[model samples]
Target: MKSLQDYTTVIRPDNNGIFAAYIPLLSGCHAWGQTPDEARAELIYVFEMIQEEYKEEGRSLPEDVELVIANAS
Candidate 1:
């Protein structure tokens, strides 16, 4: 079973000063807020909603999804 912990979260600040949070492996799964913490909280809520939606639709999140972290300078 794929859980929220199975996904990699990417949070970054945009030029507009809003923080963007998303699961890169999940299409259209995203949220935005004024701070990184807020963005993350919103993302958690969105993820739960998405899970419920998929459950109602008799579908499951992709099991092949993988998470990779990289550092850039």
Candidate 2:
């Protein structure tokens, strides 16, 4: 998979204690969670979805594809 670019993830709390996971790289694919853990979990799915989309679409995975860890706190 040739990565076109890398993306950043921003996680923030919501009104209901759920976090909004944002992929700075992608315009969409945000997920909500009742907790930071939940948000993180959702992010996994979001990330996977994007990869699958590319695979199913017969597209190559971006070179930037990597596990988001530095952004984690």
Candidate 3:
């Protein structure tokens, strides 16, 4: 089973002093909060909701990917 921690979360503070978080792997999955921690917490909830929706729709959940860089010779 895939867990929330399996995905990569991007969190940043917006100009309005609110923290915004989004999962790059999950399209349109985002949340906002007053602080980074709060934003992350909300993002977790968002992830759960998205996962449930996928399950209901009989779709497979997206998997996380790892990026690798290689030096060009």
With a 3 Å backbone cut-off (N, CA, C), the pairs that clash in candidate 1 are none
Per-residue lDDT over 1-73 for candidate 3, one digit per residue giving the tens place of the 0 to 100 score: 5778888778999999999999888997899999999999999898889999999999989778874548999
Per residue, candidate 1 scores C-alpha lDDT tens digits across 1-73 of 5666778888999889999999997788899999999999999899888888888999988763566668996
Residue pairs whose backbone atoms clash in candidate 3:
none
Q: What's the lDDT for all of these models?
A: 0.86, 0.70, 0.88
Candidate 3 lDDT trough over 10 residues, lowest sum = 61-70
Task: Order the numbered candidates by TM-score, best leading.
Answer: 3, 1, 2
All candidates: CA RMSD in angstroms? 2.7, 6.5, 3.7
Clash counts for all predictions: 0, 3, 0
Structure candidate 2, residue pairs in collision: 2-63, 3-62, 3-63
Please identify which of the two predictions, 1 or 3, would achieve the higher TM-score against the true structure: 3
